[model samples]
Target: MSLRPLTKFGYLGRTYKFFNGETLYPFGYGLNYTRFKYSMVSSSHALQLKFGRLQHCRDLTYEDGTARPPRPTVVVDDITCGKELDFEVDIQVQNVGNVDGADIVIIYSKPLVGIKETHIKQVFGFQRVFLKAGENKTLKFTFIACKSLMVVDKTVYKVLPSMENMIVIGDEELFLPVQINIASCQN
Candidate 1:
């Protein structure tokens, strides 16, 4: 019996130009790597004076399944005094299993203070960090608050520091508790 052209499974829309009945497994296919660990060492949050928004505030998440709900730290932003602040998010990637694997790092920031889901940026910033057999990598990411967040009405500003108002991290939004004076918030 003959099969219909349209009904037949063909590689008409696949990335590869050719198709065959036999399954193809390219090199590195099915290759699995060992699990690694990632952790957040420290983080800082502050409100920007000129931008009227939080300066250099962000959330860190490790690719490791065991790592979640990364801890956050509040830091002072005194750029003038050469006190530049950068969140040194600590992450560890280890190959727990016999086989080695690679992991991708993702950092998400949402204005949980005064912005809604619609206002948040899509495709949260991401960084790819690779790990080898029984190896780990410590990563650091600097987050700068959106400039648009500044100049918001004072009423909106009040929303900050309030648990109700904060940047959304992921599905579970986290409202970090922090207060920054104008003098110390100069970035």
Candidate 2:
């Protein structure tokens, strides 16, 4: 199918999602004379955040005020971002090459399978650091799980519990698996 019809999703021409899909070059595709190595400095479970079951919208009628069969929808205003969902990931980037240079690190989040019509991946956070040859720097990326981790299903914002959230870095796809938990929930 032509991606032209997915105007709502914008152009599928760019590699905003799937990393392993057939493509010449995708997001974070860049060339550099110097090479960098990325290693996780934080705990693998550092991304633990809270999620809760979604509640359906109370307005049962259609937008035009016509009564119809009830459908699952989220109340846009009712959605709240709690502190329980804030987390951070720390990664150390070392310039392994013999030349000093600056590199931009793009953090991409691969959506959990439970969400439908989801992007193959989405940008979470990014950082650019200039490191001397053989120098290494630690970069901290903060994420409000409710924001970057949220997905709109049927036009309503919601977060679902999943252990499949994947974070990829740079031109190379480094898989970082994270578990999302439900805690101190707000109804």
Candidate 3:
């Protein structure tokens, strides 16, 4: 006799709905009593703010077990092909409501090219920033472009560069879009 593996459900479970027309208040859903606005700031370095330091900022090996040198952090507009780079986005969130409240900031990333079997979008990081009425705060999110290419092969995990990476930020009503190019590393 043969038996099937058990299935999971809920937020991070495999049976969760992540697309349109499926359901309301999908994953990472939160309600706020106040209104907030988000805007991207122009800066030389993608990661300009120094409020907190990144815990993991280092080079990673490829699937073939080859070591690559660490790439320098540069402005988002200057990223080119063949360069392993780390970048960040600075978003300003303002509480335009009349009362004090908190807003949960969620960050998600998806690969333009599908990697056999993987989630449509995965949460990489998130932060909950509390703001008083008419208060504005800037949150910086830094990410290594290549680190999003993780894949599971058999029982071992490997990192492979994707053609393009799509980053999304969950705000009040707007979803911020940021694209990263990783074509050069695929060759």
lDDT digits (tens) for residues 1-187 of candidate 1: 2221222444232211112134466211334546544544444455433332454432322323444442221232312222232222344445556655665554443333222212232223445656657666666554433221221222222122212123322222222322232322222
Off by over 4 Å in 2: 1-15, 18-21, 46-77, 154-163, 183-187
**Cα-based RMSD of candidate 3:** 10.8
Better of 2 and 3 by TM-score: 2
TM-scores for candidates 1 onward, in order: 0.39, 0.69, 0.57
lDDT of 2: 0.62
The 10 consecutive residues of candidate 3 with the worst lDDT sum are 1-10
Runs of candidate 1 exceeding 4 Å displacement: 1-33, 47-90, 113-124, 147-187
lDDT of 3 at 22: 52
* lDDT value for model 1: 0.34
User: Candidate 1, which ten residues in sequence have the lowest lDDT sum?
Assistant: 156-165
Top candidate on lDDT is 2
lDDT of each: 0.34, 0.62, 0.50
Tens-digit lDDT track of model 3 for 1-187: 1021123322233432123225566677777789888776634332221212322222233323444444322222233323345667677889999999998777676543323333456676688899999999999887665454333322233433323445566733444444432322211
lDDT per residue as tens, model 2, 1-187: 5321254555454345533336777767778889999988766554443335544333222323444443233333455656665678898999999999999989877655534444566787899999999999999997876567554443344544333467777764477766654444433
